[model samples]
Target: MPRPRTAPSRRRRIAVDHGAPLVVAKRLALVGAGTSLRPADPNRAYYPLGVALERGFVTDEQHQAGIAYTRAFAVGLRRPLALGIASDQAEVSDERRAELTIAWRLYSAALAAMSRRIKDDTDNLVLYERWPLWLLPGHVEHEADQRHRKRVKLGLDVLIAVEPKIGLAIRETRERRGA
Candidate 1:
């Protein structure tokens, strides 16, 4: 006969460095909230970082750093850790929830584009610049509308900023194949 499993006394734990800059705590909190609120699909865990990049909420460097931090934080957790964090500890503000909703929407739009084989540079440019009109037709009128144009610009900016990183990954893959 096998013994039954038991829950750990502590679900999650982190040590504080009081001497560190305030941004350290803020970044940890951001990663914690992001990880806790992530959807069940593990592959989509980084979606919020992409959304943050798109909205200029975080710079490319910060997004990259946050990804490392978030993954580390996640690796230390047990299965029920997020539930305890969400229900008993963390106080998720309405504003944070609203931000998460926007992130989800942006991620969903990206996934839709990927599914449609819009992964090339030209297709990405078109999709990002015109996504608002197609994805939220009720809100955007003409492509020239200020609101529509702003959304388009924001999306395009994110794509442009991240493109080099994507290209580097592709180059690395090609090099590995050649080797």
Candidate 2:
């Protein structure tokens, strides 16, 4: 009889720089990407946000809060909050589109602020307390998880490309660190 194959182990650590604006930007980008109201599919029932919650990137409370925030934003705009298309691919008037854009910007800012709070919580108290159950031993990294990570990376890339100021700041920080 053939023996069963075991999965390879992945050892990773999460580190945050509280004082670096560049880090904040990257984290904000990550959160923004992860929390996007993407379509829910069989492979991704919750899409990006669910992945973030599953991967220990964010807490359950935070995930729920994000959902509520997105819904509230949609309601404020007088739009029917539907899944996926409602937030990501909805067709709306110019004014409604502008409102959506502003709402997303504000949400992104809130995500950035939350990232800052997590970083500033020194002593790793919050980190230790919120250590995700998924990171425990015997946890297997699935293909879905890999896809989620890639999506977040792509989002970060887009953010850097679109925000010249953030890109410049990151470049300057790298130069200063001789990286």
Stretches of candidate 1 off by over 4 Å are 1-144
Among these predicted structures, which one has the highest lDDT? 2
lDDT of all predictions, in order shown?
0.39, 0.43
Over the stretch 1-179, how does candidate 2's per-residue lDDT look in tens digits? Answer: 99666555443455665676665554444334342454212232224454455445555565454454444345435445433445543455554454445544544454354454323221021212222323333458787645544433333333333344433544664576566
Number of the predicted model whose TM-score against the real structure is largest? 2
Candidates' TM-scores? 0.24, 0.27
**Residue 8 alpha-carbon offset, candidate 2, angstroms:** 40
lDDT of 2 at 49: 50
What clash pairs does model 1 have? none
Residue-level lDDT tens digits of model 1 in 1-179: 99776677644456775765565544444333343444222222224444434434445665454343222222222111221222422455544343333433443355345443323322232322223322221344554645434443454454445444544654665577569
Window of ten residues with lowest summed lDDT in model 1:
76-85
